[model samples]
Target: MQRIHNVTQLADLDDDAMARCYAYPRQLDRPWVRANFVSSIDGAFTVDGVSAGLGTDADHRVFVLLRELAEVIVVGAGTARAEDYGGAHPDPARRRAHFQRGIGGSADGAPPPIAVVTASARLDPAARLFTDAEVAPLIITTAHADPDRVAALQEAGAQVEVAGAAAIMPAAVLRVLAERGWQRVLCEGGPHLFGQLAEADLVDELCLSTVPKLVGGAGGRISLSASGFDTPMSRKQLVLAEDGTVLARWARR
Candidate 1:
């Protein structure tokens, strides 16, 4: 791995940066998925208890760009709670880009929906994830969640549905989104969710921003517990941005 100091280095690169280093090809059609994350040099998911510390100006720009390209943004409930994320509407400039790219914008006019995966139905109804956007949030949960809570979220203007049991199974969630015409899903993860998706063979690409600093703590990692997989998963070469970040894509063999 190399450390990149500027985004200019990636200006001339093509999809190879996303494909060769991240393992995602531009040729993928519906049901295509990607995991976007940023990490410290030492592999910590956070510093001072926040992920914003790991992001650079270029990283944030790239993150927004990725969001603009996605049809729907999928996130684990824990990540949503931690980050206090709202809807998935790109900013004005990015929204225009999305419209040009054939994403998020109907002739009638509607923004893209944000998908939050949770097993527990205990999230706060007044959270930013529900209040921050014009469009209603989509809460994807398992059968184990509380019925009353689900109804409550629904009443609060969220589209709540039970998609799987135990954990929010990635394959099941992807199938549901695919049915709704959400062919390209972007997962902004919080580690555990990334692990679950990878274990289920649902992740097709990984967009990683490698930060320059390092946090030596043992608190959080770029991935969650590894108990679900029967064996280790492997990755394929994708693209390497000029800033030293890498994009990798992988699939089940």
Candidate 2:
């Protein structure tokens, strides 16, 4: 890792090195909410209708590290479907080191689970997110969500939990995650979910990777919302990879 002012932040990206880079918060009152995203230099979060275009080896490396440190990866259903998110296939060495190194406060030793937030529970029953899950993909919904669809998801192998009444509330989502004993919440977003977190003032950190490319067209930016805020941020780390992928870490201020 390198500092924004050309100072050497770190010398390597080895296991120990990366682990230290993404170490979870030392102390917490509640779950620490963090989000990860990749974007183009033009401020586009998605290209060709997805976020895959704005990715690089370095960004992916950091992505894995963040997941390794998190105890529960919270994501919007739309992003999960778009990214083809299956169960976490954690690296054996990485998973082992995470426990041994004590990344976050887990009740017992286990890789983080994926908790997907959705209103309709329309995810496919056979989707790898469920069938091939390492940990059963948790389905978060509202009481007012379609009950029939909820039953379908429950039959589909998801542990459905009602977190709200009509619309999915951020606080309710956090309550469900905490009930599962997760203290580190990693949110991989698709705008809607991110906006909700922002609206509720729940975002603690953001890991953004800037790919060195220009994708000029109609595409989603990092944020899309009816509710927006001029939130202040503190730069925690700024590293320029050899491939010019600028990986930045910021804390909400």
Candidate 3:
């Protein structure tokens, strides 16, 4: 992993450091999209593992702002399981801002839908995700998943669908999103999902939040592994944003 001391070192930053961090790629006009994540100096996505504890006051503000801009939030099942994700409900102030922009509904309305990608259909419905968030959940699965299991989630009111024959393919997921008229999709990942997306050439941009501290553990890293391409599949540049966070944008060739 690359390390930098401060946010100013990034070359592409704009006046509102937050806006620059979430800027979309020019090539990604619709359907496909990207967002990045990073941690704070403590080497925690949270104080433990949740995202809520990773940022400064400014960082948290920008984090919510990014969610407001996205039409859907895509996350791997492991992340959903670990984080106990409920939905992509932005704060009331941010929701109002989205309403002004005609993206979200009134305060009483539901938040943006969440797309959960999983290889197996069997997951704990009692997991904090379903019980906590108000928005309905969308499950993307493979044909390998059990039909009865899918039915259970459906009975519980989730919208479940098969996206690939064996494992969920990034391309098929994007196609499904396009069909639903979801143009801006934000992917919050565990390393495995990030590796799959990067290898499949599905990601358009990244909003990495590079924290200052490091934990030399065998488990955590920005990516699981590099792609097996004979040549480079893409290139990225970093931009320094608020509170020692670095946003890295990668465009796939």
Candidate 4:
């Protein structure tokens, strides 16, 4: 990968450099919500019904790197189901990278747990999220969710927590994760969840990868909020790949 704009002019960026560029702040006392997402050049977040088709090799690399940097990943239930979500896996190299950056690693060297936000608590108990996870997922749902479904998820070994009454609120989700000492929070969002977080001004940073393709279909943008609001962002970093993919990082201003 190469950094083409607003940088120190590195023609080629190696793995270590890339990790260094994307590392979370070493000192974080509160949950810093960083959202990672991919979309087409025309602003379509997905090609067909799934987002997997919009990803490139460069995008995938950054996706994994973001996962490595985070303490917990938050996603909407619709996204988790559509993407066939799984738990983050432990990366020894990333742990060492964190240590080199003076940011302590997980004591057990375990992967970050995924926190799924759902209003109805309608996740599959037998899904790969539960059965094939390196760490147990935290199911964040509303208090009014179906009792039987909540009990079923708990029975399947998930840590289910109530974050709201009738709906899942973004601030409450952050509070829940913050209480668990998950300071570096990453949200792999479906648009609605991203919208809510942005609306609540809970989002701190955005790591967006733009694929070079153009899908002018009935697709959605990276965020879908109930009402429009403006939150200015400052470009932090920009990188380009050989395949024409552009990855950029934006910080809330």
- Which candidate achieves the best TM-score against the true structure? 4
TM-score of 3: 0.75
Please list the Cα RMSD from the true structure of every candidate, rounded to 1 decimal place: 4.8, 2.6, 5.3, 2.6
Write the number of the candidate with greater TM-score, choosing between 2 and 4. 4
Weakest 10 consecutive residues, lDDT, candidate 2?
3-12
Candidate 3 local lDDT, 115-156, one digit each (tens) = 888889766776666766677788999999988888877877
Backbone clash count for every predicted candidate, in the order shown: 18, 0, 3, 0
lDDT of 2 by residue, 16-111 (tens): 776777788766669889999899999999887788778898888888778777888998999888888787765656666776666752434456
| Better candidate by TM-score, 3 or 4 | 4
Clashing pairs in 2: none
lDDT of 4 by residue, 1-253 (tens): 8845655322387767887788788888788889999999998998777899888999998888888778889999999999898777859676556656755346556788999999999999998889988778999998899999999999888999998899977889999999898988889998999999999999999999999998899987889898999999999998878888998999999
TM of each candidate vs. truth: 0.79, 0.91, 0.75, 0.94
**Residue-by-residue lDDT tens digits, candidate 1, 1-253:** 8854323345565532422223223444568777888887788888766688778755675676676566678888888887888886665554554455454323333456788889986778888877787778888898999898998888788888788877766788888788888776788987888888777767777777776676687657767766756544345434455666554434444
Better of 2 and 4 by lDDT: 4
Winner on TM-score between 1 and 2 is 2
